[model samples]
Target: MPKMKTKSSAKKRFKITATGKIKAAAAGKRHGMIKRSNKFLRDARGTMVLSEPDAKIVKKFLPNGL
Candidate 1:
Protein backbone atom coordinates (compact mmCIF):
# COMPACT_ATOMS: atom_id res chain seq x y z
CA MET A 1 0.00 0.00 0.00
CA PRO A 2 1.10 3.55 -0.60
CA LYS A 3 1.90 5.93 2.24
CA MET A 4 -0.74 8.41 3.27
CA LYS A 5 -0.12 11.98 2.21
CA THR A 6 -0.56 15.09 4.34
CA LYS A 7 -2.95 17.87 3.42
CA SER A 8 -0.91 20.74 1.96
CA SER A 9 -3.13 23.58 3.15
CA ALA A 10 -3.45 22.15 6.63
CA LYS A 11 0.28 21.63 6.76
CA LYS A 12 0.84 25.37 6.28
CA ARG A 13 -1.84 26.47 8.70
CA PHE A 14 -1.38 24.12 11.62
CA LYS A 15 1.67 23.36 13.72
CA ILE A 16 2.52 20.45 16.02
CA THR A 17 3.90 21.28 19.43
CA ALA A 18 6.67 19.33 21.16
CA THR A 19 3.96 17.57 23.19
CA GLY A 20 1.89 16.91 20.00
CA LYS A 21 -0.78 19.54 20.43
CA ILE A 22 -2.00 21.53 17.40
CA LYS A 23 -1.34 25.25 17.43
CA ALA A 24 -2.92 27.84 15.09
CA ALA A 25 -3.13 31.54 14.61
CA ALA A 26 -6.31 33.41 15.57
CA ALA A 27 -8.51 34.55 12.68
CA GLY A 28 -9.90 38.01 11.78
CA LYS A 29 -6.67 39.98 11.51
CA ARG A 30 -6.02 39.73 7.79
CA HIS A 31 -7.71 42.95 6.70
CA GLY A 32 -9.85 45.86 7.95
CA MET A 33 -7.51 46.16 10.88
CA ILE A 34 -7.85 49.91 10.88
CA LYS A 35 -11.40 49.58 12.21
CA ARG A 36 -10.58 46.90 14.74
CA SER A 37 -9.94 47.66 18.39
CA ASN A 38 -6.41 47.82 19.80
CA LYS A 39 -7.25 45.13 22.33
CA PHE A 40 -8.35 42.69 19.64
CA LEU A 41 -5.14 43.16 17.66
CA ARG A 42 -3.00 42.87 20.77
CA ASP A 43 -4.77 39.74 21.91
CA ALA A 44 -4.29 37.95 18.57
CA ARG A 45 -0.51 38.25 18.52
CA GLY A 46 0.34 34.67 19.51
CA THR A 47 -0.68 31.18 18.39
CA MET A 48 -3.40 29.31 20.28
CA VAL A 49 -3.63 25.62 21.05
CA LEU A 50 -6.58 23.87 19.50
CA SER A 51 -9.03 21.86 21.57
CA GLU A 52 -8.67 18.08 21.76
CA PRO A 53 -11.38 17.34 19.21
CA ASP A 54 -10.07 19.89 16.73
CA ALA A 55 -6.50 18.85 17.29
CA LYS A 56 -7.32 15.28 16.38
CA ILE A 57 -8.62 16.43 12.98
CA VAL A 58 -5.55 18.56 12.33
CA LYS A 59 -3.10 15.83 13.33
CA LYS A 60 -4.28 13.72 10.41
CA PHE A 61 -2.99 16.37 8.00
CA LEU A 62 0.45 16.82 9.55
CA PRO A 63 1.92 13.34 9.14
CA ASN A 64 5.59 14.43 8.96
CA GLY A 65 5.41 17.66 10.97
CA LEU A 66 6.42 21.16 9.81
Candidate 2:
Protein backbone atom coordinates (compact mmCIF):
# COMPACT_ATOMS: atom_id res chain seq x y z
CA MET A 1 0.00 0.00 0.00
CA PRO A 2 1.08 3.55 -0.68
CA LYS A 3 1.90 5.92 2.20
CA MET A 4 -0.85 8.26 3.25
CA LYS A 5 -0.10 11.91 2.64
CA THR A 6 -0.80 14.59 5.16
CA LYS A 7 -2.46 17.88 4.32
CA SER A 8 0.32 20.43 3.96
CA SER A 9 -1.78 23.46 4.79
CA ALA A 10 -3.18 21.85 7.89
CA LYS A 11 0.29 20.87 9.04
CA LYS A 12 1.48 24.47 8.87
CA ARG A 13 -1.57 26.04 10.47
CA PHE A 14 -2.33 23.50 13.17
CA LYS A 15 0.03 22.03 15.76
CA ILE A 16 -0.22 18.88 17.82
CA THR A 17 0.63 19.43 21.45
CA ALA A 18 2.28 17.05 23.92
CA THR A 19 -1.16 16.44 25.41
CA GLY A 20 -2.51 15.48 21.98
CA LYS A 21 -4.61 18.61 21.59
CA ILE A 22 -4.65 20.87 18.55
CA LYS A 23 -3.10 24.27 19.27
CA ALA A 24 -3.64 27.19 16.91
CA ALA A 25 -3.17 30.93 16.69
CA ALA A 26 -6.01 33.22 17.74
CA ALA A 27 -8.05 34.88 14.99
CA GLY A 28 -8.86 38.57 14.17
CA LYS A 29 -5.26 39.77 14.08
CA ARG A 30 -4.77 39.64 10.33
CA HIS A 31 -5.97 43.09 9.12
CA GLY A 32 -7.46 46.49 9.97
CA MET A 33 -5.65 46.57 13.28
CA ILE A 34 -5.47 50.36 13.23
CA LYS A 35 -8.88 50.64 14.87
CA ARG A 36 -8.61 47.65 17.19
CA SER A 37 -8.15 48.30 20.90
CA ASN A 38 -4.93 47.61 22.78
CA LYS A 39 -6.74 45.19 25.06
CA PHE A 40 -8.06 43.14 22.15
CA LEU A 41 -4.64 42.86 20.58
CA ARG A 42 -2.93 42.12 23.85
CA ASP A 43 -5.38 39.40 24.80
CA ALA A 44 -5.17 37.79 21.39
CA ARG A 45 -1.47 37.17 21.77
CA GLY A 46 -0.15 33.58 22.09
CA THR A 47 -1.65 30.20 21.08
CA MET A 48 -4.92 28.59 22.10
CA VAL A 49 -6.30 25.05 22.05
CA LEU A 50 -8.91 24.31 19.39
CA SER A 51 -12.37 23.23 20.47
CA GLU A 52 -13.19 19.52 20.72
CA PRO A 53 -15.41 19.42 17.61
CA ASP A 54 -13.02 21.41 15.46
CA ALA A 55 -10.03 19.40 16.61
CA LYS A 56 -11.70 16.21 15.43
CA ILE A 57 -11.75 17.48 11.85
CA VAL A 58 -8.11 18.53 12.02
CA LYS A 59 -7.10 15.13 13.34
CA LYS A 60 -8.09 13.59 10.04
CA PHE A 61 -5.16 15.23 8.32
CA LEU A 62 -2.70 13.93 10.90
CA PRO A 63 -3.27 10.20 10.63
CA ASN A 64 0.23 9.13 11.65
CA GLY A 65 0.22 11.14 14.84
CA LEU A 66 -0.96 8.20 16.91
Candidate 3:
Protein backbone atom coordinates (compact mmCIF):
# COMPACT_ATOMS: atom_id res chain seq x y z
CA MET A 1 0.00 0.00 0.00
CA PRO A 2 1.04 3.54 -0.62
CA LYS A 3 1.91 5.84 2.21
CA MET A 4 -0.73 8.34 3.20
CA LYS A 5 0.15 11.97 2.80
CA THR A 6 -0.39 14.46 5.60
CA LYS A 7 -2.26 17.67 4.86
CA SER A 8 0.19 20.50 4.35
CA SER A 9 -1.96 23.06 6.13
CA ALA A 10 -2.62 20.74 9.04
CA LYS A 11 1.07 20.00 9.44
CA LYS A 12 1.78 23.68 9.82
CA ARG A 13 -1.14 24.56 12.08
CA PHE A 14 -1.51 21.63 14.47
CA LYS A 15 0.82 19.52 16.59
CA ILE A 16 0.31 16.17 18.26
CA THR A 17 1.39 16.06 21.84
CA ALA A 18 3.21 13.16 23.53
CA THR A 19 -0.19 11.94 24.71
CA GLY A 20 -1.70 12.30 21.22
CA LYS A 21 -3.76 15.39 21.84
CA ILE A 22 -3.78 18.11 19.20
CA LYS A 23 -2.21 21.43 20.12
CA ALA A 24 -3.01 24.62 18.22
CA ALA A 25 -2.76 28.37 18.55
CA ALA A 26 -5.76 30.07 20.12
CA ALA A 27 -8.19 31.79 17.82
CA GLY A 28 -9.35 35.47 17.91
CA LYS A 29 -5.83 36.73 18.59
CA ARG A 30 -4.88 37.56 15.04
CA HIS A 31 -6.33 41.06 14.80
CA GLY A 32 -8.48 43.81 16.32
CA MET A 33 -6.72 43.58 19.66
CA ILE A 34 -8.01 47.03 20.68
CA LYS A 35 -11.52 45.57 20.99
CA ARG A 36 -10.42 42.45 22.83
CA SER A 37 -10.20 42.45 26.60
CA ASN A 38 -6.88 42.11 28.46
CA LYS A 39 -7.96 38.88 30.10
CA PHE A 40 -8.84 37.37 26.73
CA LEU A 41 -5.44 38.32 25.32
CA ARG A 42 -3.63 36.94 28.33
CA ASP A 43 -5.50 33.65 28.16
CA ALA A 44 -4.86 33.21 24.46
CA ARG A 45 -1.14 33.81 24.68
CA GLY A 46 -0.09 30.19 24.10
CA THR A 47 -1.20 27.07 22.29
CA MET A 48 -4.12 25.10 23.61
CA VAL A 49 -5.27 21.52 23.29
CA LEU A 50 -8.12 21.00 20.87
CA SER A 51 -11.35 19.55 22.21
CA GLU A 52 -12.00 15.82 21.70
CA PRO A 53 -14.37 16.20 18.74
CA ASP A 54 -12.22 18.81 17.08
CA ALA A 55 -9.08 16.73 17.67
CA LYS A 56 -10.68 13.76 15.95
CA ILE A 57 -11.32 15.87 12.86
CA VAL A 58 -7.75 17.15 12.78
CA LYS A 59 -6.37 13.64 13.21
CA LYS A 60 -7.71 12.65 9.83
CA PHE A 61 -5.71 15.41 8.22
CA LEU A 62 -2.58 14.21 9.99
CA PRO A 63 -2.27 10.50 9.30
CA ASN A 64 1.11 10.45 11.02
CA GLY A 65 0.92 12.58 14.16
CA LEU A 66 3.39 15.43 14.07
- Best-matching candidate per lDDT: 3
Candidate 3 segments exceeding 4 Å error: none
Point out where model 2 deviates above 4 Å: none
TM, every model: 0.83, 0.85, 0.94
Model 3 agreement with the true structure over 1-66: per-residue lDDT tens digits: 998998999999999998999999999988899999999999999999999999999999998763
Looking at model 3, residue 40 earns an lDDT score of: 96
Per-residue CA lDDT of model 1 for 1-66, tens digit only, reads: 897888889988988889888899999989999999999999998899999998887787787642
The positional error of residue 49 in candidate 2, measured at the CA in angstroms, is 0.6
Task: Please report, as a residue range, the 10-residue window in candidate 2 with the lowest summed lDDT.
Answer: 57-66
Evaluation by lDDT, superior candidate among 1 and 2: 2
- The true-versus-predicted C-alpha distance at residue 46 of model 2, in Å, is 1.4
RMSD values for the candidates in order, in angstroms, are 2.3, 1.5, 1.5
Number of colliding residue pairs in each model: 0, 0, 0
Q: Under the 3 Å rule for N, CA and C atoms, how many clashes does model 1 have?
A: 0
Clashing residue pairs found in predicted model 2: none
lDDT of each: 0.87, 0.89, 0.93
